[model samples]
Target: MIGSMPILLPVLEPDAKEGDGKEDDSGDDGQRLANRCFVIGPDGGIIARYDKIHLFDVSLGAGESYRESRTYQGGAQAVLADIGPAKLGLSICYDLRFPYLYRALAQAGADILSIPAAFTETTGRAHWHVLLRARAIETGCFVMAPAQSGHHADGRDTFGHSLLVDPWGEVLVDAGRDRGVSLFTIDLDAVAAARARIPALGHDRPLTI
Candidate 1:
């Protein structure tokens, strides 16, 4: 999801469809727009927009504390978008730690997942890559994560290893703690192949205690 910002949006109609995202004149304005991601399709129109569901609210003692919920309301819905080659699921940084959400998206036919994160340097260094790879492996979906790197003007640091992980849990590209771009061709077939080989998504059983 794009970083935090207060956005003013127009009111939406009840008859609104999925292909185009519409907002209106009777503005609904606030910090809701900040923590969201949009999937633009081949035709250059907005196909889907997913608001970030999980907020980062943790007290990392020694004065290192973050309260994302203080700024914005978390999203109440999960969205999967049609992006021609694959059904892409949208989620933000903190949501990556929740596997059940990814499983729900996969069940809804998502073959590719996007995580746009502004992760803190401490936790990102420890859990970022591994968690992303695990999600890809479990869902058999290609995971594309674009992250915020280096330092922000507020004197905070981010662990900026923007990763592209394959369905087979391979690191295709890692944008390591630098302000730059990483581009690669995503082979959709790899998703199919990996899922066919492992089929882990199909093996899920009910949680029985």
Candidate 2:
């Protein structure tokens, strides 16, 4: 788990400029912000890149509305990258609510998952910890969540409490209600042990809708 300090004011792209009535320039401005994924291999080579899939677009108190989709383009696929002894799965903020995506990645052999988010204070307070722990328990995988905290240049506030959880629903490292990176030396044996105990993935039953 590596949580960096909140990005106060990320540079907005020229194409991501708001208030432009033309749809052709709808997502131009968001391209300016740096939303990239670097899959560092055991031999130290960047093997894959997975951009964010969802945008933060909501209305808070007092008629304040944010439309992130206006500036950013959604990612097309979920990425599973190999980094030394771990198969890491990548995701971002809003992707937490979607369990199917995570399940698909786990099925594809992801043992460690990464969810780097810039979550809002309201939602984070309500659901962040629970959702993260749940994802870990459900998939029987280790979860690393690096977050963006504090206020941003756009006047939006973010709740940052990055966490690193083991496969058995235990938080190994918690970066409390502040900033900075939180690191942990994960044990792959824990993943194997947890999966051996529960074996939920092998017993997944097809539900009929």
Compared with the true structure, what per-residue lDDT tens digits does model 2 show for residues 164-192? 98889998888977867654677888888
Instruction: Highest lDDT: give the candidate number.
Output: 1
Angstrom error at residue 97, model 1: 0.8
TM-score of each: 0.82, 0.80
| Candidate 1: regions farther than 4 A off | 1-34
Provide the overall lDDT of each model, using Cα atoms, as 2-decimal numbers: 0.77, 0.74
Error of 1 at 8 (Å): 19
Candidate 2 lDDT: 0.74
Q: Which pairs clash in the backbone of model 1?
A: 10-24, 11-24
Predicted structure 2, TM vs. truth: 0.80
- The TM-score of candidate 1 is 0.82
- Name the regions of candidate 2 deviating beyond 4 angstroms: 1-34, 42-44, 60-64
Clashes of each: 2, 6
